[model samples]
Target: MSELIARYFDRLAGREDAVLTDLSGGLRRSVTGRDLPDLTDRVAGWLAAQGVQRGDRVVAVFDNRLEAALLLLAALRHGITLCLQPANAEAQALADLAAGLGARAIISAATPCPEGATPLTLEAAAASPAHPAPDLAPQTPFTLTFTSGSTGAPKGILHAAESFLGCAAAFNRQTGIGAGDRFLNVMPMYYMAGIFNGLLAPLAAGASVVIDAAFGTPTALRFWPRVAEEGITALWLSPTMLSLVMRLDRGDKVLPAGFRRLFVGTGAMAARDAQAFLDSYGMAPLQSYGLSELLYISVDDPGQPHFGSVGRPLDGVRVHLDADGRLGFSTPHAFLGYLVEGALIPPEPVFATSDLGALEDGILSILGRSDDIILRGGVNVNPIEIERALAPLFKGRGFCVTGLPDATLGQKVVLVFEGATARPEDDEIWARARQIVAQGPGRAQLDARAQIAALPLGPTGKIRRAALRETLAAAEGAA
Candidate 1:
């Protein structure tokens, strides 16, 4: 009943005159703080009308409009367990997430909400009557987020109220950003990072956020000017967005006028991209490391550059390395666990994050993923390291490295290349990559080969490692 998160929203409700914005404008729109409280109340009222009792599982599938934000705050304020499914996901994916959350009802812009659930439209929700706030466990479920499922089926991560609150506190301490700051939300709200750190964190800090659900190169260019017009100070982006903005000269076009701090994550950002951001915009990008399981565990912070590193662990979080050299993380914001067959469970609290990294002198250096590594002749080869090195060699040519199944070695290294280079020998590329690796870490320990061919990328620009592996396997069989 007295949770800091609840108190935070209650405070915002009292200050109804404050301003918050959303993607209502193609770029951004300004909404007064006063309107937020009423909107939140109405959304909660709508939930109540739909038999959404406190702590009831309520899923939202509305477009990336302000209504989504209203639904989020409403559920949090009323102590409703909030589960958000991406509006753009396939029907099956949305159904799976809703079922996993045990959703009693789902809010959507579309009519005839999926079966097994009642539908509440944003346009019909009424204002909540004055009522005493419901009592809730400090560890009560607030948000149930699903992972991107890039590597596999998405996993549902449950977060308690305190852990959700702690993210804002951690962000405040790490970024020194606070009230009066304006934030732009470009990434989808379904993402743990986007919803929590990018949205809730700023809200908890009493700052204004502008949500833009439709994200693309053209949309980004169009939005930059609005950010300046709105006097927005900070924004968060994924690595993909960062690359697009840089290429579009987004900073030169608009950022210098209104934007200040930049936060980025969601994948490994290239050093070149970071450097390009700095050189062009004069804004130092803060890199963060976390997952759906942990909200915001570590951050590079403003002006602090660890180059390839994601940065030190956040305050009140512990990061350790296991005997196998895998990175283990413990934090207050860690998820309760994923849902399995209708039951919420607890995963390994001490996450052996498929990621491998080293902690030296308080700086954490990610060494790629242990799960994705290829083993050749009993030696481990990190595809990420190889990709980073080989990416430059291609020089605009597309390339990806992945592990292919091998009976003798467990997994054989396969490099997929695209683009016409005058020099097109598979053996030659292998020799060159090896030379680069020889000078880098795990020098002689890596036994790998390279093959050049057309590589495929997913819609998000990520290498389709799984598909590439299959193609390479066929090639190996032909050989």
Candidate 2:
């Protein structure tokens, strides 16, 4: 797509035979940007050949490949709005999604489509004849991303390539990551964090990206070596990934050259986890705040780290809290709207969030999500308070303190611990956590608790508290 992100990459091409997009893992197939404009134009031509036209909807259910990113560009260049579904989505779900969105086509390498939708491969998209640049509308969204649906059914969040470019620019204003910076990407490209923070953010600032799908302990252990190999200067990661790497970090005394920068977001990060990484690495990871609907609201300063806050608002972004401490942001980078009934419904971008937060000296700290608070016996309970109190028990392992249905109390607090081994000391630990929560601030009482064999993670590798709630509810029902 003759859009902001693509222009950032391909604009500097044809001057040098540079390896722009580097795939770091098993399959190193990549999108070389030497003639990237030419490739994207051909891909746009391929979409034209497929009978897709302007104002059309296309869903690219692609994996973490860099080519997938290019196809996104192609879709945008053709003046088409595009959404990406999970590559591993069930056929029926994919079909239902496509049918619901009235998508003209589905693009993927191996994902199956229902009988009605057209599926195209990157090979065909790349081989077709070149098409002319589009006369793009100012505010048309090039990327259509669906939320993780942790709370309910997923809703589409629309963002223009211009929005992403603006997001990148805002981020660059804070972090100063630009030319000569190589970002290592492991997060899924289908979502906001991966696409905006991992891919587009760097490219928009004249930086290259290294896409690696591999993760977990083995990958985390080998991370710095790979950073050294790839000359990666910046790190973009989710909190879960950061915790994993922090727990299993080899504790290198002298770090790899140009590997100083690290960032964590896409989910909440506990103060202890953030502190641990800083203590180990001698540099604090930059903490940030945002969601798919709006992003880059605040980012931490790497020099003087705020222990509990998500840092200050980005340039051109304003953050204010309501009477109830609910946070709201006003930014030009906000989403266009949510896709509904095959048409775009304008979003209330200035809408207040359900999050309870506070600002102290221009720094923002989130208390917790209002929806995550448990009402027990007319007492409001913030799960984050309990989570913080029990952070030591988890020891880099994940845990969640949430509410469960209770007839008498209206709701009850339940602690679910994440681990592979069921500790013989679990009963004692649960008792300790309960006592701590009861004695601590919030005066939250635990009704019951259990240890899970592993973290109930969603498809995005984020801990799914909704799934945990369901499991606990089912167990209670069985009892």
| Cα TM-score per model | 0.85, 0.92
Candidate 2, overall lDDT?
Answer: 0.74
* Residue range 40-80, candidate 2, lDDT tens digits: 78877877877678788877776677566677766656678
lDDT of 1 by residue, 31-85 (tens): 5766665666677666777777787887777555666676777777667877766
**Number of the top candidate by lDDT?**
2
Where model 1 places Cα greater than 4 Å from the true spot, the runs are 14-18, 24-30, 92-101, 109-122, 126-132, 147-155, 250-254, 347-349, 395-398, 418-479
Best by TM-score: 2
Clashing pairs in 1: 16-34, 18-33, 19-32, 19-33, 20-31, 417-453
Question: What TM-score would you give candidate 2 relative to the actual structure?
Answer: 0.92
Runs in model 2 lying further than 4 Å from the true structure: 1-11, 14-19, 30-32, 109-123, 148-153, 251-253, 419-422
Clashes of each: 6, 3
Report the alpha-carbon TM-score of model 1 versus the true structure: 0.85
